[model samples]
Target: MNVLLQVADTAGAACVFLGAAICLLGVVGMLKLPDVLSRSHAATKPQSLGLLVVLAGVALRLHSVMDLATLALIGFFQLLTGPVASHLVARSAYRTGQVERGDLLFDDLDAQLTEPGQEEGQGRRDSP
Candidate 1:
């Protein structure tokens, strides 16, 4: 095998291993975290990083440029959507009272957060 190909294969293997490890760590965090917000953080950051790295590894291992382009597109979409999706889920959980207040150090959104369908100037929350 050519020296460059050998080096690339080694690098790709390393990326795959590291990516898998990061993804596993994220899964562990999601399971071990005390609340919904922390779990959402765990699910997004490391998981997205892992997904990108794994996609890179797959791209490196593939023979065709078309296959690599597909991997790149998948990784790009994952990067674009992962954090947004997690944030939406976390925000919905917090609004629905699923988050643990004790775990929160500070809440800047307290004043701005509002219930759905609430009228303007209704204050921070809608009365139950």
Candidate 2:
């Protein structure tokens, strides 16, 4: 039992450290990325993943059921909201012309925003 507890504690500490590193990478990505779309991607993806990892580490350390439930809830909300928020930020940036169209290889939103009446069967426009 003592050995198992020590292992769990070591694992939890490792997870927490790894998660913090992941989040730091995300921040670096945001700073280094050229555009809003890329920056938002950096902001959400790694951050969400890091947060979940951190929560998992906390769960391992905390044997209490109620604390685990709270951590689960936090992870759930982070997963749910992160992408949605990133999407909105990217969408607004694109709409405002902050995104350079030429940099994109394929533009799905172009048809929808430029020609709203176009049918879905028309397919996405290839960026020139």
Candidate 2 lDDT over 1-128, as tens digits, reads: 99998999889998999999999999999999989999999999999999989888887799999999999999999999999999999988887789999999999988676576556336456779
lDDT of 1 at 117: 63
Q: Lowest lDDT 10-mer window, candidate 1?
A: 118-127
Candidate 1, superposed: residue stretches over 4 Å from native: 102-106, 114-128
lDDT tens digits by residue: candidate 1, 1-128: 68888888888888999999999999999999988888999999999999888888876778798998899899889989998999889877876789876678887655465547665445554459
| Per-candidate local distance difference test | 0.85, 0.90
Model 2 clash count equals: 0
Please provide TM-scores, in order, for all candidate models, with all chains considered together: 0.81, 0.88
Query: In model 1, how large is the Cα lDDT of residue 12?
Result: 88
